[model samples]
Target: MERVVSIDRVNNLVKKSDFISRDLSWLKFNHRVLDQARHLDRNIFERLKFMAITASNLDEFFMIRIGSLYNYIDYGKERIDYSGLRELPFRKKLLTEAQDFVRAQNEYFIKRLRPLFAENQFKIAKISDLDEDQKEKVKNYFRKTIFPMLTPMVYDSYHTFPILMNKLLIFGVVTVSQTDKKDQKKLSFIQVPQNLPRFYEIEHNGEILFVPIEEIIREHIAKLFRNIEIQSVNLFRIIRNGDFTLEESDDIEANFLEELKRKLKTRKTGRVVRIEVEETCDRWMLRILKNRWEIDEDNVFRAPEGGMIDLTGLWSIVNHTEFKDRMPDRHPQVPPLSYSEQGETDIYEVLDDRDILLHHPYNSIEPLLELLDRAADDPDVLSIKLTIYRLAKESRVTNALLRAAENGKHISVLFEVKARFDEENNMREARRLQKAGCFVIYGISSFKTHTKLMLIVRQVEEKVTRYVHMSSGNYNEDTARLYTDLGLLTTNEQVCNDVSEFFNAITGHSIPTIYRNLITAPRDMRQQLIELIRKEADNARQGKASGIVIKINSLEDRETIAELYAASQAGVKIKLIIRGICCLRPNRPGLSENIEVGSIVGDFLEHSRIYYFHNDNDPILYSGSADVMVRSFDRRIESLFLVQNSLLKQQVINILRYNLRDNVNAYIMNEDGSYTIKESTGEPPFNIHKEFYEVTLDDIQDAKLF
Candidate 1:
């Protein structure tokens, strides 16, 4: 057995102080996202899309973060948050902030977004706002479609309370009995069908009319409760605690597949953490619900005047074709920077000659997919091994792998079934792959395999060569077009060996070892990165040029943040472009004065992870799936491979440069953890999203060397 080393527990107050609450930082990131919706620079439909994105983002936040917090509070387990508040106080503060955010979100939709949408010939109509003809159409549609799907469950003395599904819009109807001598009120619930569209759309007079399904039901709900006096009807939605740790079940550690299935079923009916009720809901009805759910007023959010309970349903309108032509077309992807070839070049041939580094969305993921397609049919190919965290709904990656497996080529796949919100998709895909005779591993026992890696072995004439693909994003082709990510396709001998060994260790019982180029995690990535930072600090103290530049999605790990603080104190300039959940207190006096942190929320999600360290004059670069989060280091399995090729290294540095130069959609982090938009003082608009789309070889040649 490996000896357990006792390290000094004293962090000298670094852990508690100078850090923003993780939850609060995440909410702030959402606020940044919300700002995109408010920004008028984007097209109307794009702005609507951003608004829907924020709504979807908030739904997950409530499910995961809010749900995780109550998992402690509800069970009476004492815990402290990053903000130094104990479980009870933290819960109070967190819920208050969450309620405030919901209020602002609703206010935005009702006040600004509604008017803007109205100006664009779009209207979310109520039954009262609709003409008699439109009302009759809605009534007929409701009776034909939504009426049958709704099952009105009564909650009274004889009946039990039904299990309300999470995140579903429900109509809480309070009715009085038809024949009772004494007046009595009864509560009945009707859940809006998940299958039906959220809105009944009717094109009228060149304007798009979207009537909320709830509104239509409100108009005709009397048909369901015939002869009964409907006193009041409240439209509301509930967000249940959908977060569950694998540790909660012994069955999870034993049979993960079965436990995952069971957990998916239970997630729908988890404890109610939040209730978003229409602002006009009767107080007594609200009180009854709060009392039954055993929750305080803090748990309920009053929806704005808009009848829509869930703003995420706005995606239906965003996807509507009425304004499709008004939106800008997607930018065409240029050929990848390093490979220096067009579409006709063979991927294997290019990779054999030199490594190819791709900056995604700007550069297509086609070459990587093409490589797999060719490898699947290639007579020289022996096997293909890869790790999958999240797969696209319609995945070319999976299809290619399936074809490879069917061609009698050995395929080893490590599918992460522990990916939250993606577990069902991963599970289904993994089972499909397994049925196709592909050797599928359901991740490691306790940890998620978040690394995006693939190794293909082939032999032309008794000489075997390995081609490997590594990336910072998923194998999801759809996301590849929406997310800014970096990927490498190479035949480098050292990286290939390291990836092969990584697969061996993950698939079998052997412990993962240190690699020559790949800095793997739950073991070495954190220490390796810290050592590099300290080395730069050492260089800075010696009066040599020293700097650190990193672009990642989140930076929440305290150890890494402390190292960056230490590096800043040593006079090493640090620049960070974090897209979300940055907990580091940048630009603070005596703490992190030399460090600058900025975030860019643009057309594409800033999903890539890049680490650049100035080694005196030379620079070290790496791109990988790992973020600066503790989970990426100590909990999940991750890998960061060095960009050894000089050209590829420069390309990464250029990416960092472009990200640092981003101002249009960029927000700079302040000492207090709030973000301010990075304003350009009369400088020409230089949007990285636009610049990268049209990047040519001459542009790279003329660019100043980092």
Candidate 2:
């Protein structure tokens, strides 16, 4: 473990303290996503999808970031963060900021969506506001579907607060004892079962009416507590600290899978971070609940007027097949540019000729899946190797590997079992692969192998030839359709050989001392990035067309930020397209005057990492999984490879240009640490996603690239 240091040490190292707080920057990013929900041009259902995404994003933020802050405060670790605040003050600031964010989200939901829903003849009706027929339907649903599932848990001197599941909605019920009216009111809560649908939809004479289960409970919850006088019934939810550590024990030390299962249980009992109550919650009731939870005012949140506590339940509406016409048209994935060359569908043949660059969601991932599926059954293929960071629940990639292993081919798969939230799934897949006779390595201890890499060793005419696939995202096919990422399919000997060595370095004891065409983290990725940036600066000083363009998910590493500042100081124009947390203070005179940062949060997530350096007309482009974060550089195992193929290089360059030029869905980061939406004056509305879908690969191929 690295030593815990103060912000003084960080400032001394960087020679400046102009970085933004990581947590606050993340909140700003979420707000940017919220802006997408507010976009008038997007379809209503698509806007609702954006809203649901922001809700889910905020939930995770509270569970991880807020949870970690509490831990820091509890442990007396008063280390100042980048924003020059200690743990306690930071926690207070974040809590207040989060409260405001949730308020805006709820206001938007109520003000915009309610009218939109009503106008569209789809209404989320309250129980009291419903007509006689609708009321009867809700009453029937409460009896038939909801009544049998509810169990009201009581709390008193002998009883304790129930182990509330994380992010699950629960109702706080206040009741007066029948025997003594003056006695303290009994406090109880009924948990809403996640298995049941959160809303019940009914068709009324061509119009659809959707009603929340909570509203139904408000009318019918008295039945759960038979004899007690129900004084108040208010809806509430709590987010808990989901962060957990794996400790070594006798049984756990031997069995990591069992340990993971054990640790998952502890996550439920984690400390409560935030308690969300309805705005109409009684003052006395709120006070009593806060006392019981041992939380202060900062941790309590009141729902916005007429807004539900969790917006994730809106997904059912967003994903309804009936609403398809109201949502954006789903564009079919296009075939790769390499596919039309001599009309070849075989990835091996295409890769053998030249590298294939894939821009996902716009371009299909079928070619990569096809590569694995073919290698599994190929008689010449001898071995298959892959690194598993995250995979779909039903992964075609995993299925291909299983088939290859079943066919007597040697298979080695490293499942990073420490992947947050995906740990159990990866463990399950790892054990399943192990049972099928494949060599399954859990992970390198204390280091997550986040690199997206795969190597297939095939013997063609008694000569071993390696085929490699590297990506900026995971092997999950489901995410490929939602996240815009770059992938490379190559048979280049040096790149393939280096990737093979990378696999060996992880799965065995052999260290990769030399990498011919790849840059890996915890090795040389950071150093390589610094040198590339400095090279641009050097070129600018020597009177060459020098600039740098970076498109990444985040930028938070202090050393990297310092180097960027230095580069900007030396007159190297830098353009950063960061989709998430960016700590670097750009566009500052004498610090980073030549730098500009823009973020895009659109229909699809901008997940690909593309780093470009204008090395005096002969530009260099590299893309892989590593973000400009401290963990990616110094802790995690990451990979970034050079774009050597001419056509593929232009494809990456074109992607950067498109993102740089997008005005409708892009926001430029301001010097005040906020973002302003990029507006179009008289120019056509430019949406890179829409353009990517409309313009086919053949059209892109025909276009000239300077």
Candidate 3:
């Protein structure tokens, strides 16, 4: 075990911290995700999803974060993190810490959560525990269903080891041939068919019994090895490196697709990162398997409670009818916001009346959906342009764009094919759009088009008018139903022009050199944000009620963090609601004494990025994709639109105020970067999300009645 340092020492080290690496901070955020699994208030299926999410997140972490770290280590490059602290060379130390993290996760899964699952009637039974009738059913099922798909391999001097597919679960068994005079031994293996269900349900005496598929395979091993006596059986799983590398050749487009296919194949043979073995495995069998795989002892994990190596199977258990009712239904709340009374009300006109903010899941995404739907159908609309990062599987937004294209409206869609894990989805959608007569842009070769904006040009009579919809989330209606985000529909000419130019630049039409009222990244967002913070500091020094409120997914940008620290020193009262990866340390004496940071994690994901600066005479508000991260500001394509209308600014401020006042679900972040749930007081505890939902629903209904 690595030496454990005192909390004070860690704080002292952080005091001089120049850059807190975003990767490490991100890992801490994943810990928070894991924390949700431990939360009692969350439903069982929700908890299961959280666990699956964490596992899925870690897999990506290994592919991206750890993969990047390994690249840096290989090249002997030393880079500092967002905190400006020098990162130590990645060697044994980092690997050791990673191993420790995995071990802790395993322990938490087994000791804390799995037992609770078992107690809740989600039983995982073994074959030995089966009765005569149950055993008979299992035998019949295996013979009829599993036997046909079985491909068993035996290892000897003549036979080589079979190729184990990545993330595949299999069993290694030692068998002795009864026909051999010397009782010759052979090493054999059988895969738990990926196509087969992880758990098999048997109905016995009107009670449901679930047994792992591996148990049935174990019981039927004798059939596969007809003339052998099974000496020992051990279950194991393997994780291989799955990082995809894109080539920079002249035929980049063709190369990319080819590389993607190659990656899919290479994923099975890449270096092993992790291996898991059942606890009951014999020492000799374990050694032989490890030696064959060339896996080190540190890479091996022993399953607890003789449990199955992978509990992702718990997803199947979650599907059982008994637990299904307990899961929250998040769809009904996202019904159409506008009624028949608001008939054909122009989205831009509605926003012009007041800055309308929509809370997803609780309220509805229909207003935003309606905006695009109307744009597509409106005959007067000449052109529609937008940037798509990751649309939903069945994207209404994409369908709207297709409709616009088919209506002879010139449509441009900037599809970012590099949106991690959604690469294939985006690529498929891009091809579909192209086929549907839409001019599709595959995004800039270097930077991802992460900004979410829609531009509509309409020719009404003798005049050309521009309408824009700017948002802090994707146009993905499905996620819009679950992710809390903000969208603004406006006829502001300056913002519209900037957004149009942005789409044009991304699609290789024309490079936009300057944005009039918007802050765009890889260009001016960082400097503009710093200048905004400085303005706040100046206002504070002049004795005005200077304050700043920001709600973002992350706050790991060093310059932004330092500027915030400076603003805090200048008496600017700063409140930050960061949902994830916060590097800024708040409430420290002489450093960030005036700054307070908190996070809200609930049923819906808080995905919007909103910024409010008290400008003394006139406050300024903006919302966009930028998250105060260096990469967001300097590497990726991002946009922040200045909220010009007073009513809209007030609405934005109100949302921030509500979030800050939330006590029921808010987790306050301390100066040391740790978080604690807000303790309830005597006053009615504010569930900001729920309240926002009710307020929006009431407002929409009232507007309809009026």
Error of 1 at 556 (Å): 0.8
Give every collision pair in model 1: none
Query: Which of the predicted structures, 1 or 3, would earn the higher lDDT when compared with the native?
Result: 1
Which candidate, 1 or 2, has the higher lDDT?
Answer: 1
Q: Could you tell me every candidate's TM-score relative to the true structure?
A: 0.95, 0.94, 0.87
Scanning candidate 1 in windows of ten residues, the lowest lDDT window is 1-10
RMSD of each: 5.1, 4.0, 4.7
Best by TM-score: 1
lDDT of 3 by residue, 434-529 (tens): 898998877666676799888888887998878787888888878877788887777777787888787777777586778886888888889999
lDDT of 3: 0.74
Error of 1 at 33 (Å): 0.6
The full ranking of all candidates by lDDT, starting with the best, is 1, 2, 3
Question: Between the candidate structures 2 and 3, which one is better when assessed by lDDT?
Answer: 2
Best by lDDT: 1
